[model samples]
Target: MLAHSFMSDEKKQNSPRPLILAVEDHDDNLVLMSYALESLGCRFICQKDSTNTVLVAKEYQPDLILLDILLPTISGIDVVRYLQQDALTCNIPVVAVTALASREDKERILKAGFNAYLSKPYMIEELETVIRRLLCGKIDSTSGFELCKE
Candidate 1:
């Protein structure tokens, strides 16, 4: 085996690398999510605190948001609602990526106004697909942008 093997550089890859917002309190979860996003080769903004999601979202202007239901100071539901109400950030998609695994709970979250709802411990492919669709504006309906060509 060669001692000095040159690894393929990640930055050189052509993935769009959107500014995805990952709002999760768990450090491990955040890291895990980062790993998944990294595989897709996308950059991200993380908000470990629930209270600061809007502020961070506004500042970062992420393409999509992955919110956890159980958060401090504020709930993910409120954050989703807030984003939906804001004109500047309203067009962005807010997807619930939580551990709350109940059809009733999902329905409730959907009713509260989320662009999409996904469960925690989800497959990386699912997360990627979901985020891709949302960010690409495939969901449409008062949202912004279309699927990126490049």
Candidate 2:
């Protein structure tokens, strides 16, 4: 199977893609989430947990961040707070890609300063729409995002 790989390992060696910092803990969820992102024509750097989230964000300087609520070292709330507080990284928009997407969860994360939230088991179009809206400033709200129109 390895020898018959479609791309021929050689081509796979130099795929140049922009990096996005994805902070997720659960392995299965991470795979699913990544699949959706890739399906939407997005590329990223995956961080297993919150421990290296900051360092990676700083170093990698990804186009956007996808964070989980629960992490190993620090909480996702704290991660948002930290990014919002620091002037250098303050402009970066963070989205809560987590299972905690209840009303309170949404309210708290927004209050804590996340640009958006995408509940688990989400669709590719949803991620694409949210990211496009955020990047283009089409959705006008206090968080700099407009609510989805009905």
Candidate 3:
């Protein structure tokens, strides 16, 4: 299986693309994230196995990480803890993207050190906003997208 997942677009070459590390176990979810990143003119590295996440993050040092909370072997929270402890990968921003939509779940996720929390079945615009906000520190209001509330 390919460890990295992305779709190339020549039009995005005018400028450097932001590198994103996506940790998702499901193929469909990876595809969806790939589409989103492609549309945003960004490059991404994907890992289906959570156990290798910290290793990959340290190696690639992506600008941002989209992580799923639940995984087959190790939970995303554990992965985050590993990343946080590693000086090489500690500075990268991590966003929780999962099905955990309850208010308490969101709070717990934020408390666990995720820079942002985005629930599953999210809108494309919402995904873009969060990515831009965390990576760029601000959203482009000209995109006419509003913040999504959970």
lDDT of each: 0.72, 0.66, 0.80
- What is the Å distance of residue 133 in model 1 from its true position? 1.5
What TM-score does each of the candidates earn?
0.77, 0.73, 0.82
Cand. 2 TM to true fold? 0.73
Reference-based lDDT, residue 88, model 2 = 64
Best by lDDT: 3
User: Model 1 scores what on Cα lDDT?
Assistant: 0.72
| Segments of candidate 2 deviating more than 4 angstroms | 1-18, 137-150
RMSD of 3: 4.8
lDDT by residue for model 1 over 33-110, one digit each (tens)?
777665665666666777767766776677778888888668999988888888878888888989998999999998
User: Candidate 2's error at 99, in angstroms?
Assistant: 1.7
Best by TM-score: 3
Higher-TM-score candidate of 2 and 3: 3
